[model samples]
Target: MLNRVLAVALAAGLVAGLAIAVLQHFTTTPLILAGEAFEKPAGHASLDPAAGLRFSGATIILAHSHGEGAHDEAGWSPTDGLERTAFTSLATVVTAIGFALILMAGLVLSGDPIDGRRALAWAAAAFIATGLAPALGLAPELPGSAAAPLLARQIWWMGTAVATAAALWLLIRTPGLWAKAAGLLLLLAPHVIGAPRPEVYASGAPAELAGAFAATSLVVNAALWASVAVAVGFFWQRFKPHAS
Candidate 1:
């Protein structure tokens, strides 16, 4: 069981990560670069591509520190072309694998039968819990966008994800009406509490451009999760005979 789970996760993560990286390279990457144009001051150095799809916070785009040219002064980052692409792909793959492991563990715990169709449902739930739910309160932002403190945002994001996941499990897996009612409350609790926010809304990027980036990021992340499901489903079926 352990070996089968790891194998499926590895394969799914690779496929999803590569797919997302390619999509982002053409889509979100350009938007991020354009947003950075607004972020750079008269003489400040450019920020790195490290702001996208990190495993941390379940966010497609992360908030970048814009004050004092902190992006440049913080530490070494991959340069603009192939190096950045390589780093992004690596980070994405690692993040995908982490997510995959979580999904696989849930499957194990649930003891549910696995297939492409079923896995697709699971992936959609995962996307909602980890991506869309939190995004409702905290949309993806470009580097120059104003944001609350990172730690606070992280805490809220995690809470939202956990709440959403538990709610989903209750709604889908449990049968009682009480379970459904509890699920509904859990689903709404995070949004009711609200996400952390900056006192003032500000950004170096234009409103139009930032909106575009947020929408594009959500699309890319959706594709990533879907791809993971397809890959996991494929691998799980393929390896079933050998799983024991």
Candidate 2:
């Protein structure tokens, strides 16, 4: 039983980790797109009939907006090429594997054996503490978009919590084909709900700038949940089949 549990945990962890990494890599936009507008310039032009005079002037302005709101998104750049993408993916994979190993060690020491009920409880706690709370803006703002809409942030967080809970529940309760399908659906739920769109610039922005800030949030959130999942799985494994 222990062996079976461990095998399943490892396999699930790997898939979760890989998904997180790939999502992060693809979603990460160039640093330029992550910035906020520092200023907004304005000008006015008028013509006078009496003197037949025309006047036009522009003034410099500044703002606190940062990240996704900074400049026309056209300024942002994508990763140099496929090679850089591969490197990022590899980095995420390594981090995921390391996290899994650590979780396995912790589970072995928790004095309880892994089981469905325990896994569900742990996952639930994690979802509430880490996922739900952050969705409510209890968590710090992400680096790229300091000015991201509060409502949008809340939506993202709520979606994330639901997805995580569903995935964990399915994995712990029913480890079968249908359960796997449900888990995958949970994983992809956020994409369907979509993220906040960047405010359009009158001047136009770069093409690669599409969904830059949203992508960053997705990556960061995924990493956080992936870490929690591995940790919960490890600890659950340790406490399962505890000797009374």
Give all TM-scores, in the order shown.
Answer: 0.85, 0.35
Query: For each candidate, what is the lDDT?
Result: 0.82, 0.50
- Expressed as tens digits, the lDDT of each residue in 56-141 for candidate 1 is 34432222443455566656666678988999889999888887887787777888778777778888999999999999999999
Q: lDDT per residue, candidate 2, 120-211, as tens digits?
A: 45544454534443443333332333244778866777767667666765766667999988877876676566655546422122223434
**lDDT, residue 53, model 2:** 22
Q: Global CA lDDT of candidate 2, please?
A: 0.50
Distance from true location, Cα of 147 in model 2, Å: 9.4
TM-score of predicted structure 1? 0.85
C-alpha RMSD (angstroms) for model 2:
13.0
Worst lDDT run of 10 residues, candidate 1, spans 54-63
